[model samples]
Target: MDTMRDRFAPVVSRILDEDPRVAVVLAEIGLVPFLEAQRRHPDRVINVGIREQLLVGAGAGLALAGMRPVLHTFASFLVERPFEQVKLDFGHQGLGGVLVSAGASYDVSGGGFTHMAPGDVALLDTLDGWSVQVPGHPDEAEVLLRQAIGAGDERVYVRLSVQANREALPVDGQHLLTVREGRRGVVVAVGPLLDQVLAATEGLDVSVLYATTVRPFDAAGLRRAVGASAADVVLVEPYLAGTSTGAANDALADVPHRVLGLGVGRRELRRYGSVDEHVAAHGLDAASLRERISGFLDVGVPGVPA
Candidate 1:
């Protein structure tokens, strides 16, 4: 019953009431809930108008002043527009906060390029120890968020997208959770793409590993997931294509492996269409992913049956 938007307000409110060191910075995104938060805790909740740079700047200042800031905005504005601030303010200053972003990758397809930011996670990855989380379900989002907040001053990026999974899979730790087993290869599902990836590989011989946390890439867990199989790994992410390629390569350095990366398409589509159309174009939908991944497992996976 808890949508990501609905769950966020209560979490922010609870943090404001329970932790005096917490502050929520807004850039005119969630107006109503944020306004109520402002009313409840006037000083702690800050609305910095439409200035994304200032939004992050204020958060950095807040952190410098001994406050754990939570900055909310679209992915583009929060990360792309104010990237310098994110790098200099948080990374250089050695300050940390929570960055809860909506509209992951092409989720805002109708809004076009200005609103779409598939490269946000990659940009943050270049900075420092940013804990990136892509929760598949709203229930998962809530659980992951509370865990992120529990780590004070840990830079956490929670990417929230429109699509969600059928249900919340059991997730107790940051390590990968295997939902289904197979004999050929392993499919690592990141964030909201779990359901779609599951659908894509339903009839295939591939182990599915669900991960809510992307940053601090669980290499050991990934190795465990690969096990003694062919080590054929397909990382299905919801962000930019090949965003986690480096991490994946680093994770399986010791093992001789064949990996496939899938996510948002790199090509620019000028036309404004439905989200489903965009999703299909990016090769993120079940059918497209099934085709590509099937090909990978069929030809690329060694000693594995198609």
Candidate 2:
């Protein structure tokens, strides 16, 4: 019911008002809102300039000194650049801090390839005690952000999409928003694309499941839900499907899991282009996703060996 800015503004305002030890760190473009919030309450914010490495490193240092730090940065800069600091300083030392990575995936359309961090989801998993989340919408982002701040963990990355397009889904971690009662197969959507999958279920008896949490999935709950469905399970993610947690759903459940890997194909980091074109080229667009679903449905499951 609340707007994205509305959801974030109040919490940030409250934190600034009460938590004197709470400091906000912004990296480059992520500084847009941090600066605005700082203007509103100039005394409380801490701008880390464009040094993303130092930005994370500083957050680690601040947390080590018993201060609460909320660090904001683009997904690529926040995850890829200061990875050593994040792993060694935070994960190893067990520092307490929140790293809010904004504009994940195609959200960085205008920012080009250099600004977009495709490897973050895969990279974050390498750390031992990190909590990684990718919220489909702004409202979900708000809830996850609140959770991350209060988690009191060494590291947490709330991967956020740029556009606030879809309305917030009832995040009960149930059915991922029921699409349609179908006999064919269940389409599991990872993020914002749940809307498109729902739309594609017009004539088909399709069910859509939104797997919101990447790392800590509710396996027992998911198994119960998918077990109730007659169709096979198809897991879809915004990025490459198999390499990330999207693929792990197969191992987590007994259902016949079909992982749909989306996003750009891995290659030499030679090409240069904005994020939108890159995603589109990789078949991450709405039409491409729909086509993939249709193909999956048409192909059906191959006869399994007895």
TM-score of each: 0.94, 0.80
lDDT of 2: 0.64
Cα lDDT tens digits, model 1, 221-301, are 888888754578898988788887788788888888888889877788888587778888888888888888888887333
Model 2: per-residue Cα lDDT over 27-110, one tens digit each = 665455555668866745777678988888888887877877888777778888889988887888878788877657646556
Quantify all predictions' global Cα lDDT against the true fold: 0.84, 0.64
Candidate 1 wrongly placed segments (more than 4 Å)? 299-306
* Worst window of 10 by summed lDDT in candidate 1: 297-306
lDDT of 1: 0.84
TM-score of 2: 0.80
